[model samples]
Structure formats: structure tokens, C-alpha cells
Target: MSESKSYTGGCACGAVTYRIDGDPMAVRQCWCRHCQKLSTGGPTHNAFFMADAIAVDGTLASNAHAADSGNELSWYFCASCGTQLFGASSARPQMRAVRLGSLDQAHELQPTAAIWVQEAPGWVRIDPAMEQHPAQPPAPPPQNQS
Candidate 1:
């Protein structure tokens, strides 16, 4: 069998670092207002992976709030530099969304879908090739058990 891919990244101030031992289940660009605010007016790119596949090596600060979809969302960041690292939704507790920008520059992941597009700003231009969802989509399929 082929070896699973590994990815490593850290917060801007180097106060937080993480490693993932498997491939992402999905990568998406989220245009939800909450995500926009976190991204400073742009969409947040994230790669979703099984929570069990990730290992974090630093203390992280986090905030939790109810999202428009009514899911309890929690975001983790670096306390020193405030760089967003990961986001988790109560709806999918077994998964974690890792901010694409927080990953090492060499990582090749890309958003294949754009979600919550109805809330995107008028001036924003989403790639036409990506799958679009006007609001929250169904959860990604569960990881294989093998």
C-alpha cells in the first residue's frame, strides 16, 4: 500500500505548530460571514481531515460561537501572533478544518469547492471551475476504516 501523505505547518509567531498524518478529505473555500471576518474580508481556505490524524505541538487560543447554520463553531489561533490555525464545527466533531495559509508553503492542497457563496461580497470573484454551494453543504464522507 502507498504511504499516506504528511503535512506540517505552524502559526506566524512560531508559537503553534501541527502535523497531519493523512490526506485531506476535502478542501474548500468558505465565504460565510464568519469566515470572511476571520480572513479579513476574503474567503477562508481550509483542508478538512480526520481529527485523529492531526497532532498539535503548542498551546492554542480559541473562541467559540454559534454560526449562521446554527452549529457551534470554534476557531483556534496562535496567542502570540493571532494567526488562525484550525476551525471545528460541532456538526462534525470528528473532523477539523486546517487553514490553508497556515500550512507550509510546499503543501499542494487547493480548494475544490466554494461554500456559502450567497454571502460572498459582490466584488469577490470565485473560480468558476470549483463546485459552488449557496450555503452549508452536507458533511464529507467518513474516512475509510482500513
Candidate 2:
């Protein structure tokens, strides 16, 4: 995707900024506990982005953690300000998890799926139309490796 249709976002303090181009691959809610704590400090919520569709700038802070699956998940946030921007798994090296709330037009992006639904709290109600998976789905088969 070229830089034609741009989406601008920044941290709460404006210390970090970035832009994304093109439509995202999947906009969905995650019931993963990690997402709950990261997004709202509560139950998980919907966020959207395509792993390969975003081109971002501005050096954001990052924290790497060993997820429940034992893979390292790197979370990117504002270095100057603690604003979580995105996350990624080394296992799924090709994609990114962008914070939909940071989008310039967040209302336009609605969730399509809900992963890790078995962990979803009782209070968090989601659309029944969404396809709910109980846990992190199997990673896509590797296409490039030496």
C-alpha cells in the first residue's frame, strides 16, 4: 500500500506519532487476557490492523513478554509516554496488531471476530454475528524459512 490514504495517530501525550495506509486485514475483538490488560486495563476489546498493511514511523517504546503460549509478544508504545500502540508475536512475524483506538477515524473500523472467547469476562458482551474462537488459533503455516 502506498502512502495515499493516510491514518494518523499519536500517544496520549503526543510524544509519539505514526501513520498507516490502506484498509486493515481484520478488525476484531480479542478475549485474550493480555489484550484486556493492555487495551483497557479490563476485559479485552476490539482492535484492528493488517499485519503487513501498516507503515509506521516515530520510535515507540517496546516491552517484550512471554505470552501464555510461550511465544514472545513484543508490545510497542510511546517511549516518552506510556501509550500502547501495537503488538506482535515473533511466531507470526509477518503481521502487526495495531490499536484501533489510535486511528484517526476509529469509528469506521468495526470488529469481525473474537478470539480467546473462553476467557472473556461475563460482563463483556459481544455481537453474536462474530465468529468466536476459544483460544489463540493455530498460527498460519510457514511460507518462508531457510
Candidate 3:
């Protein structure tokens, strides 16, 4: 098993902060239209974690939208700096999709897959090693209950 590590980070303006304990569930790059719109450069790098593993502080604003995966997605961000934070999906209430860029060690969480490749622009190149999906990939089975 991969060694568990803790992470801490915040918004650009320093108004919001968060901490994540232990390893995340999954990490991936999202190229969906919504993600593209939300991204500053290109694909949105996302790291998924159980809600209980995250601890956040400060004010945030959120917008709920229907995700391509047929889940209701609530995107949360720092209200002051407009920095995207994490996305909460109703379909997976226990899961929180955090914006990898907001992590202090964002580079450590590399994506293993790319989703919504069909919506990516022609200029975008999908990584050869990462699994690619045209749309929403099949979700893994829910975590085993202890």
C-alpha cells in the first residue's frame, strides 16, 4: 500500500484553507466542458477523497450544476480570491473532488486517467500512460464499509 501523507493548502488570497489526511481515493484529469471552463490553463486536475478526510476553514461560494456523469455537482471556491476548491457530487455523497492546484504539493498527486477526452480541444494532448475516456468513466465500486 502507498504510504499515507497529509496535505495543506489554501486559496491564492489566503482567505481559505484546507487540510487532507491520508491518501486520496483517486486522482484524474478532467476535460469535460465544465472543467474546461473552470480551468485556468487546460484540463482540471482532480483528487478525490472521502468527505471525512478533509477539514476546511473560511468562507466559500458554490454553484450547483448537472454533471456529465448525471450527478449533481456543487463546485465550491474561495469567495474572495475566486480560487476553485473542491466539488461535491450528490451521487457520491462521501466523495469530494478537490482541485489539485490548490494543494501545496499539487505535483505529487498525478492523474492516472483522463475523462471527457472527446470534449478536449484538438490542441490538447492526452497523456500516453493515462487511461482515457470519451465521457464520464465508470466509477469504481463504493468503498468497503468497515
Candidate 4:
């Protein structure tokens, strides 16, 4: 087990901000087409954490879409910078996905898995050491306070 200190972050324009505590349950590099659309044709490096562990501030613009799993997913972004910051999904109400790029400490968080490998473009190279999955990886354990 490992422990990470609380961290604060925001969008590039500082219009939307967040303070999150506790280590993330998982960090992933997702190559789904939707992810590629979000990241300009690259994987989106994201971290999943319990919703209770985070506090967000400032106004945001949001959009809803269906994920590859056919679940409703809503993303919140900074209206000023058009930077996507966080995501909430109907399939995983207890968890929220934070875009790693928005985190001030993103450099320290590494993707432990690469998902949607089958959808990745041939030119993209994923780390050989990372766990790869054709689709979504197995669900992570629920957050535990004790």
C-alpha cells in the first residue's frame, strides 16, 4: 500500500479548481475513441478516486455522452480554457475520473494500465510494462476509510 498527500489543481485558465485527498484507486491511460477526441487523438491519462475525496470549485461547462460501455458519462470542463477537468458516470457513481493533466502533481502519477488497446492507433506506442486491456480494465476496489 502507498499513501499520497492531498493535492490541489485547476484548469489551465484557473476557471475551475479542485482539492483532492487520498491516493487514487487507479490511474489509467485510455485510448478509446472518445478519449482520443478529448485529447486531440491521444490517450487521456486519468485517475479515478472516490467522489468524497475531492472538493471542486468554480464554474464549469459540461457535456454528456455515452461511453463505449453504453453508459452515460458527463464531463465537466473549464469554460474559459476549454480544458476538460473531471468526469462523472452513471456506471460508477461512487467514483469520478480526474484528467491527469489538470493536476498540479500529475507528473508524479503514473498510469498503471492502458485500456482500449484494441482501439488505439497503430502509430501509438504504449508502455510494454503496463497492463493492457482490449477494453475497460477490471473495476478497482471500492474506497475504504479504514
Q: Top TM-score: which candidate number?
A: 1
lDDT of 2 at 41: 47
What's model 4's TM-score?
Answer: 0.91
How do the predictions measure up, each by TM-score?
A: 0.95, 0.78, 0.90, 0.91
| Candidate 2 wrong stretches, greater than 4 Å | 1-5, 43-53, 138-146
User: What digit string (tens of lDDT, one per residue) describes model 2 on residues 40-142?
Assistant: 6453443444555666666787989898778999988888778878878887777677776666554566777788888878887878998778888654344
Once model 3 is optimally superposed onto the true structure by TM-score, how far is the C-alpha of residue 105 displaced, in angstroms? 3.4
What pairs collide in candidate 4? none
Question: Compared with the true structure, what per-residue lDDT tens digits does model 1 show for residues 8-65?
Answer: 9999889899999999989999999999999999999999999999999989999999
Clashes of 2: 2
Q: Candidate 2's error at 52, in angstroms?
A: 6.0
lDDT tens digits, residues 1-146, model 3?
Answer: 56678999789999999998877778999998888888865988888888888999999999999865687988999999899999888888888888898997645788999988999999988888999999887764455455
Off by over 4 Å in 3: 1-3, 144-146
Residue-level lDDT for 96 in candidate 2 = 73
lDDT-based ranking, best first?
1, 4, 3, 2
Off by over 4 Å in 4: 1-4
Model 3's lDDT to the true fold?
Answer: 0.86
Q: Is candidate 1 or candidate 4 better by TM-score?
A: 1
lDDT score of residue 12 within candidate 3: 91
Q: What tens-digit string does per-residue lDDT give for candidate 4 at 101-126?
A: 89976457889899999999999889
Scored by CA lDDT, what does every candidate get? 0.93, 0.70, 0.86, 0.87
Give candidate 1's total backbone clashes. Answer: 0
